[model samples]
Target: MIIGIDLGTTNSLVSVWRDGQVELIPNALGDMLTPSVVGLDADGAVLVGLAARERLITHPQLTAAVFKRYMGSDRKTLLGSQAFRPEELSALVLKSLKADAERYLGEPVEEAVITVPAYFSDAQRKATKIAGQLAGLKVERLVNEPTAAALAYGLHQSEPESRFLVFDLGGGTFDISILELFEGVMEVRASAGDNFLGGEDFSEALIDGFIAAVGKQHGLTDKTADPAVYQNLRKQAEQAKRALTGAPTATMTVLHAGEPLSWTLSDGDFLKLCEPLLKRLREPIEKALRDSRLKAIDLDQVVLAGGATRKPLVRKLVAKLFGRMPAMNLNPDEVVARGAAVMAGLKARDVALSEVVMTDVCPYSLGIEVSEQLGPGRFQPGFYLPIIERNSVVPISREQIVSTIVDNQPALHVSIFQGESRLVKDNIFLGELILPVPPRPAGQISVAVRFTYDVNGLLEAEMTVAETGEKHRLLIEDNPGVLSPEQIEERLAALAKLKIHPRELLPNATLLARADRLYQQLLGEQRQWLAQETARFQAVLESQDEALILPARTELKQFLDEIEGDGWL
Candidate 1:
């Protein structure tokens, strides 16, 4: 049976189409929404959901939460002396959800339709798929969160034609999707969002404010340096954030140094602290509206989704921005999961979803990096040449031709990037490939590069040499953060070995090692230099352009040698 999974940042849910409607599957605790937290018990047994969430306060060092923010990055979170990638943590959540579905359905389910933020990049989308695979489920489709919400709403709408905006504010990410419904089709007009912004930021804002207001008085400088204290503060702030949804004021307190540091935050004070986050929210909304070529008045309704939208302040912001109270007929937290279940039903050819047709748009522009001719013999690199613009309907193929920049160039190297940036350096480097071309005078040889994007967010590039009649296809593999098929198998084996059964083995010392431990310890100039160099090196590695990465790696290695070799240490 095929099921729907909303593998969210703060919580996750599973649902399925049953008896002509979507039915949510409850976990072992009889809760539909499971906290997306994972950890290991003192006895080396794995714990997830509410059990793991509660441990965040008592055993902060053994638990990990909010790993979804690093979905497509190489960053690792340490959980009980073992380091895990974001996807690995996500897989544990998905695995638990899958078990819930199986127990509720009384059958084995192997296929799923997972929902992701519409603005999730290709790498992030791929990571979601990998997570599903790790959980023993074949991800049949990946529907965008907003698009899924629209699908669920579209199926129940009485009107045949209507346009609406989906305002999704979750725990660790935010997305704005504009969609239109006509006849029997639901179309996504545009999508925009900040991957790093969400309800967690508000909690963090409060934490920062509390520290600034009372840290020095209690001799609690850099409270976050203590994981237990930080976790306590975070939990308090989260509870306060939730309480403020219905109340005008909430008290936030954390126990530190055997004393209670308490602060009563009024709605006005909370708003003042989160003013920057609120302002940041507007940019994505404006961009989505502009990209759709529609004004706020053009929207028939603004639908809210995600748990964070339940906040009164956020709701007020939405109402103010659209000049209308947003619709919340469907529970904000459950709507996306319902929509994903509808997609699953559609995949299964269920009669309930037979009349609906959904279409999504590419959230970001996909293109290649090129060198622009500056003079007779000079050419400047790092310019982005777009092949497919953002918001274009997906399952699209777009091509653009370009000539060699230099005379007698043996081969043309094509670097693929994804973003709206005019400069390639500022964009996300997807992958690169070198196409062999006959050496000729500048602009004498041309190659047509065609980029094909599908509904799954998989991008394939085909470059054809005009003169040689040769074609090379780049499948965008071997990325540093994206695990390959072989790597996936290896990961699967490793996970099986660490299956969280009763064990007495000692923790591996190296599992707790961090690449930036020294950098975090350094002060001032040296710390700044390390950060800058590390970022520069990481960018080069992400580009996957060996020509640039090799030299940058060498330079960074030398710098690290100086820092680690006796100069600063």
Candidate 2:
């Protein structure tokens, strides 16, 4: 009745426990991995997986892919008459997998255990759960993708005790996790990552290189002016990138804007293109190791997962960095799904494997925004007490005890954040809680702000006033409207209404090129200013402030104009 699913960014896989073994369910195409893409038919129907991906080359505007990166955010995609949230888009893929399972078993599949990235935020995790619900699945548990991979690997090896590192590099995200095995427990010590960085960057790098090669071969300037041409070239570049991993050189030939374009890239040249991205990956790996206080050599085995890890250069770099070769004996693409099945077996009590208890640590710190006494008659706002330190094991709970600063303050506002920054403005405000206290003297009202992080990384905060015995809970379920099912639907509707015909609906090529240039020109301080201004713009947009909109728009327009005048755009 229950299946294990690895809902990955580029591809998805499904597996189930059967006859004391884990078996992966292949789709109708007889492939273990399904591309996480969706296509809209002329009849307003949805097609998922490989069939949808095949349509991307010609019908790019009608297809949506790589949407997993926007799971927690407000981003949506419009496909013909339908608008889809990241979750809704993802449900199409999940639903397709569900149908495949049903077809194979000749029974309805209604329940599942889905795996998510280890560094996914609370909102992202909740969004994934919502996707499952939308697909008519009773999600028994949301397991961390790395932890699931560890479970599968541990079960496969039948090892007694070992500490292993899971390095996951998918299409649009990367996560490095350190997990330890003690007795029958597989505990995660630490996790770190850049959610925006992954194989997509490598693909971009390859595209850029191909652009240069095409320009040189044809003596044409501004090859990027044609979106269709660029898209075709990008596809060729991706193929070449993959081929160069095993071959000494790879050739790409494509017709761009009615012109014949051809190029050959060597493995050394391909590695050079991705060198910067490979360097960026080291930060997360080093951070994870440092947070766990374990050396790279201390790890018993380093396991690689995700399709991107198939790159020979990535493996070589990882080996050189760790002074050891990674364990690649297991299939990289299927390991996570296999692990999910093992976890399903353990949870169902269907297997005799030792009780594999997993305790994962929080990737980010939790704190509250409060006023700090700076000097005489002066107060500055900053992050106050930290409720959960990074790398603290879960399903753990902690609370910060604080009091009101003003006398007879009937209510106190608690602003929660998740980041290591000392400044309140630098961190993300997860949400807020308002607590009522009994009328009392200054600093007399004792309020406990409790934070609990479960195994899935979902955060729950509760405020309890001791004197009045008043309690308030801030569960994701409680904030229905702000984070509502209907709101998600509305967002999807809005996105659907908006036209995304890349050739006709998007901004002019010149304007888009200018925006990209301006984005790149932003320096250290200017980058921060841009972020603040964008946040302000988003707030104004959310508030629907008609009077403030024009002024804010003008400010942003002027900023863009200045950057253009400075020859940046």
Candidate 3:
């Protein structure tokens, strides 16, 4: 069986198309949402979802979160005793979701359709597919998150024709996609975003505000040396942020190094604090609108997706910018998963989705970087000439002509990149290829570099030598990582050796980790108190009092959360 997976930044979910409708598959906790976190327990077993997230607060040095932001990069996250690439961490999450889907369906799932941000680069998208492969699933399609949301929304709505803008601001990334829906067709016109901007950044803005205020009042330095203290304050501020979503006022309180610091922020004040982030959101929206050749009034609907869009300020900003309220009838968080399921159904050629056809655009420009001569011997090395522009419909082929730079040049180097910068140094280098050219004078031997992009986001670069009808095609592998295929295999073997606890023990393990973390964060009396609670919980867990364990775990966790003044989940 094949399932649709919304492997998100903050939380991930899986769904399946059954009975002509989409249904979400719940995890072991019986919740559809799984926290995108991974870590190791004291026993050296892998822990994921809530359990891992809880450890992130307690054992900040031993857990990893928000690795999704590093997708396609050479960056690695260090856990307690191992280092993992972002794709590997993502694979763990995908494995957890796959387990849930299998258990729910009572069947094996070998394939899936995953969703990514519309503006995700080719490298990032390919990294996602690799992550799926690591999780033991074949990933054939990657739908844009915003486009998936539109599918979920438009498929159910009564409207026969509509042009909408999808504003998706999730935990760690933002994407704005403009799409048109007409006669059972959903065509994505354009996409744009800043990968670093999202709800977590907003939370950081609040944390920064608190830290600045505390530093000024205490006459201390601007930065804290302790990461634990920073993470603790960040957690509290995040909870307070959620509280402030609908409420007018909220306070963030944390006890740090024997000092109790508290700050109350009003909606107006919070907005002021997030002025920079709010300003950043406008760029992608404007870019999407401009690329779609759309005016504010031309949009038939403004569909808001992602959990971050639930904020009142976000809604107000959209309303003010578009002169209309964005649709709120559907749950923003679940919209992408639902739409992904619809896509999965379409991929499977299910009769219900036979009429639905979708198309997507390239989110960035693709071109070759070459040296350009100014007048005489003066040459610039980073000139970029685009063969395919950004926001152009994909499954497309575009070509641009380039000539030999010197007389009787036998070989020419073709360096392909993806970006809008006029300087090639500023763009993302995809790969380099060498083409053999027949000896000819400068600007005489014309070579046409053809770039063909398919729905999978993979690129095929081909160079046709006009003089001899000689052609060379190279498939650029999207792995910009440090590992080769052999090294990845070795890494995979090593990773597979790690142990993972049974799913049923996740909640107990999570509470224990939380209590242990609290013990570490507090000092003196508070530490002793947390240690005692930890012992009590440990006793209850050892006793195997199945009925009593949950209540005790909940009570202990609630007590610690109450003491810390954090209600964030």
Candidate 4:
């Protein structure tokens, strides 16, 4: 069966349209949300979800998180002795989710509707699709995050005729979309966002404050940076952020270079620290409104989405700007996965959700690079001529005419890019093709460049000569990651060979990793007690006494839980 998945930056979730409603599938942890972290165990087995996430704090240099921010780039995350691309890590997450879905549904899941940020480039979207493929799932649609959230909000649940805005600030990406709904039609009028911004930035703000405190107390120098300290700070900062979501204040503490640093940040103080990042949010909001040709007052409703929206300051910013409180009934974290499930239902033509029609637009301009000839033989090759401007309806095609610059020009290099800049250098280069042309005067031999962008954000460019009917096309096809198909297959093989611990051992492994990690942070009596308890548990485990293992495991867990303290947050 086909399911819907939210391969999010911070956490990933899977859901399905069950009994005419969306049902979120929980993982082995019995949690609907799975942390988007990947790492290696002591045995070199791949660890995902909660186990991997806890590993991140204990083994900072050996784990990867927030890799979503580099989806389309050639950047790699080094973990263990191996290096992994963002898409590769994403595939591992997808594989884990697929396994969970299969176990929960009691059947094989071969297809899904995956969601991406509205502002994600073609390369990023392609990488998402490829990741799904690597997980052995057919990804037929790449839904925009904001659009998916709107669906989950069940906009059709409201008045048929309305204009609304979606503010989606997730872990690693931000997106603002303006949409209109009329008669059973939901149309996305404009979409904009900053991929580099999100909840992680807020955590970073807290991190900076705590780091500064530690720096002053310890005089810590770089090049001798402590991974454990950074990792612990990241966890503490994340917890402090959640605590301050609605509370007036929250406390964050960490140890660096034997110095214990702490900060009790008030909401006002936290907001002040995050001023710059919060300010960046307005640009996309204003841009989306401008692109939609609507005012904040024109919106019938303002919607808040993504885990970051849980932040009180973020909500306050929205109210201050729109002059109206945004919708908050739907759980921000679960909304996108639910909406994706609804889309899957729609794709399946489920009778319950068949009435509403959805439409989306391209998020960026599409065009080709051409040289504009200046008089006296000087020409500039970096000129960008757009064939399709951003926000144009999808499954749409547009053509731009180009003339040969010189007499008898042998070929026309059809270089395609996606961006809003007038200079080609500033745009993202998608691909290019060189097509031969007959010898003729520069202006006499012209060809039409056709750009087609589909609903899924798939793009194809073709160059055609009217007279000879000769054509050349550039198709990145569905592969947009830094790796080609051959490379992808090779990587897939490598991933398939990696060992992953049995599901039953995950809980034990995670707890052991956590305890072992804490061992590195403790001292004196606490350290000695933990060491003795860990050794006892290890002896029990190694003894292979099935009768005693269960109780010993519980005993060990209780011991750790008793000492977890406030730092457990």
Candidate 5:
């Protein structure tokens, strides 16, 4: 069966369409939301989700989080002695989600429709598909995150024809999409975003503010950087961010040289610290509206999505810009996954959704590099010729023809790129191809370069030499960021060998790891109380009696909830 996945920067979730409704699958911890974290145990066993997220604080060196930001790059993060690519880390999370879907559905799941940020480049989208492959899943489609959000909101509303804007600000990326729904058709008018801006930047701003205020007084300079301390502060910053969503104040504390340093942050202080990030949100919103050829006042509804939009500051900024209070009827965090489930249903040809049609737009321009001839023997290189412009409808094919710049050019060099820059140097190089042509005079041999972009965000370029009718294709499969078949096989075997923490033991393991993490952060009485309760829970697990273990686990969870402020960890 095909399932839907939201492989987010901070969290991931699995859902499926069943019994005429979208059903979210719970992880081993029995929670719909799973932290996108991975780590290794003392015995070298693999740990995922909540347990690994907790371990991030206690064992900072052995855990990895926020790797999604490096999805299309060749960056590697190390856990203990092992170094892993971003795709590898993401695969572990996907594998865990696949297992959860299997358990919930009582069947093996082999295919999925995964959602990604609308602004993700072609390389990043390819990496996401590769991650699904590494997890033994056939990625049927890669749905844009904002498009998915719009789809969910579109179906949820009763209006037959309406225009809406989806403002999606997640943990590590931001996207804005303008859409229109009419006669069972949901059409994306435009998409714009900043892949680098998100809620994480806000947390980082708070961290920087704290360091500037008093960190130097404690001899904590750039030379004295500590991973554990950074992780602790990041956690506190995230909590403070969430607390300030509704409350006017929150406390952020961290340890330095075995001493606790504290700061009480107010809403005004946070706004001042994060003013730059708030300003960044405006550019994309205005761009999306402009590209759609519609003004903010023309929109029927403004929808708020992604977990970051829950912040009061972000909501206020959106409302003031759009002149309307954004729609929040659906859960922001789960809306994308719900839309993905709907897409999966559409793929399955569900009768209830047979009439529902959806469309998406390419968020960036795809083109090829060319040289302009200023005069004879005075040609200038590095000019970019766009084949498909940004915001163009997907599942489209566009072509452009060019001739060799120099006489007797044995082969035509094709360098495919993606961007809106006027110079090839400023654009992103996707891949290249070389097609042989007979030796001929300049501007005599013409080659047609065709770029076909599908709904899955895959780009295929085919170049045909007019003189000899020779054709060459570039599928971007040979990119350095993508792994080869041999490498995938090797990595698959290695992942199979690692002992994943058993599903049956995840509850106890997660609880113990959380308690251990909290223990490291607390002091005096609170630490002692946590230790006593953790010991009790451990004893119950060791007893192996279902009757006592169930109740004991529940009680310990309640205790932790009261102390830790409801899953903020």
Candidate 6:
């Protein structure tokens, strides 16, 4: 039997299609959403979900979470004596979800439909597939989270003509989507988002505010210098932010340098700290709406997903902008999982499904890097050739035919990119394709570069030499820097044999101390400015009764950014 999984940044959930109904499989905590955290134990065993997150307060260095944000990058997370790729870390979470599904079904689960962000790059999507493989599940298909949410919402609506927008603000990523429902088909007209922004940013905002308050109270001017204290304060501030979302005020108490310090934070103060982060969300929302050529008023209903969307301010903003109250009937945390389960059932042939064809658009433009002629003879640096514009429908393919400029050129090279930037260097390079051509006149040798985007939004670049008919195809799996199946097995085997430090004595204390010292230095008008912003942030933070440590933390981090640039003191 197949199950659906929503592998989110802050939380993970599993669902299954059973008895003609969709049901979410709860974790051991009896909660639908499982924290996407993993920690190393003293005996070298791996712990996931809430158990792992509980260790973050004291074992921050040994725990790794939110690695989903770095899915396609070369960023290596050091958990102790062993290092883990983002995919590998994600696989652990997937494995846990698989276990939950198996336990609920009373059988072994083999296949799943995992949901990803609409704007996830091809590399990131491929990496997510690999993680599923490592977790011992066959990834039948990768669906966009917003698309899944739409399927869940549309299943209940009998409206013949319906149009709505989906605003997903999860723990670590945000996406805005405009979808149309017609003739039993839910089509995504356009989608856009900032993969790096989400509820996590809000939590950081609160952390920075608490750090600043601590600095002023103790007269310690150089709070920013202490990483360890700052880390601890950030943790505490995140807790306080979550508390404020439900209560009128939250008290934060921490012992720094052997002295007990306490601060009272009103809900108003929490929202003020997060106002800046809130502003960044507006651009993506506006872009998605504009790209679909639909005004805010055009949307009949707006659906909000991700745990972070529970923030009262986010809902208020959507209502004020769209002139309609957003729908929250479906579980914000479980909607994607439920939708994924329905998709999994469809794929498994277990349900009598409708054609319900879904057409999605590419979030970013695809192009090739090419050198352009500056004037008569001089050539400027290479720039990108945008073959597939952003928001173009798929599964689609486009061809860009060009000829070799040099005489008797034996081979043609094509460099691919995914971004809206006109400059090649500004776009992300998705690897290259080289095809051999017959030795012919420079201008006569033509090469056809075909770019095909599959239903999963992954790109396949194939080049054919028109004269010779020689061809070459490249898949992201061919890249070793990004792990393939064999590489994942090898790394998993090696990880099993490696020795790692115990969670009790990781360098989290030192990092937290450094973070604290750095947090104390901003004072005078700097503190006043942040305080005013925090007041505005609290107005939003206090309005929500849901648990929101993640968003508050993000807000605090933004406040810290106002005082210091990337250059950490």
Best of the candidates, lDDT: 5
The global Cα lDDT (0 to 1) of model 3 is 0.85
Q: Write the per-residue lDDT of candidate 5 for residues 1-569, one digit (tens) a residue.
A: 88999999999989998877899999998899999999998888889999998887789899999999999888989999998889999999999999999999999999999999999988799889989999999999999999988988888889899999999999899999999999999999999999999888998998887888767788666522788788888888899998898799988888788888888989999999989999999999888887899999899999887899989999999889988899999999999999999999988889888889999999989999898989868899899999999999988999999999788999988998989899999988999998889999988999999999999988999999988888888897766687777888898888888889888888888888888888988899999999999998888888899899989989998998898867663
Q: Report the lDDT tens digits of candidate 2 across residue range 360-432.
A: 6788887788877777746676655689988898888998888887778888989888777888788766788
Per residue, candidate 4 scores C-alpha lDDT tens digits across 495-567 of 8898877776776777788788778767789989999998898898897786888798888888888886523
| Superior by lDDT: candidate 1 or candidate 3 | 3
Worst 10 residues of 4 by lDDT: 215-224
In candidate 6, what are the lDDT values of residues 1-569, reduced to their tens digit?
88999999988899987877799998654568777888776566777776566555455667787899998776888887768889888988898788777877899998999999988988899888888988888999898998888878878777877998988999899888899999977889889998989888887776667668875668544534554455556556666755766788887666567676778988788778877877888998898888899988788889988888877777777788778899998988888888898888778776456456667888889988876777765666578888888888888899998887666888777878889888988888788877777788767988788888888878888888787787888764554347766777897676556443333322222222223333343446765766665555456456653346336535655655555442211
Q: So what's the TM-score on candidate 3?
A: 0.94
Error of 2 at 509 (Å): 33
After superposing candidate 4 on the true structure, give the runs of residues whose Cα lies further than 4 Å from its correct spot.
221-224, 477-481, 532-569
- Measured on C-alpha atoms, candidate 2 has an lDDT of 0.76
Stronger candidate by TM-score (2 vs 3)? 3
Q: Which stretches of candidate 6 lie over 4 Å from their true place?
A: 216-234, 478-481, 495-569
**Clashing residue pairs in candidate 1, if any?**
none
Better of 3 and 6 by TM-score: 3
Q: Which model scores highest in TM-score? A: 5
lDDT of each: 0.84, 0.76, 0.85, 0.85, 0.90, 0.76
> Residue-wise lDDT of candidate 1 within 274-381, one digit each (tens)?
899999999999999999999999999999999989888899999999999999889988999999999999999998778888899999999999988788889999
Task: Identify the runs in model 5 with alpha carbons over 4 angstroms from their true place.
Answer: none
Q: After superposition, how far is residue 392 of candidate 4 from its true place, in Å?
A: 1.0
lDDT for 375 in candidate 5 is 83
Model 3 C-alpha lDDT per residue in residues 1-569, reported as the tens digit of each score: 77999998889999999989999999987778898988888887888898888776677777788889999898978887688899999999999999899889999999999999877887888788888888889996998899899899888778899999989988888999999999999999999998899888888888888878774575434434666676677777778788898699988766665677788889988899988999999999999888899998999899989988988889999999999999987888899999999989999989988889999988899999988789895667788999999999988999988888888998989999989999998999888888988787788899889999988787899999888889999777744763556766876787688788788888788677777767765678878888888888889889898888888887897888787654355
Q: How many residue pairs clash per model?
A: 0, 0, 1, 0, 0, 64
- TM-score, per-candidate, Cα-based: 0.87, 0.82, 0.94, 0.95, 0.98, 0.84
429 Cα displacement, candidate 4 (Å): 1.2
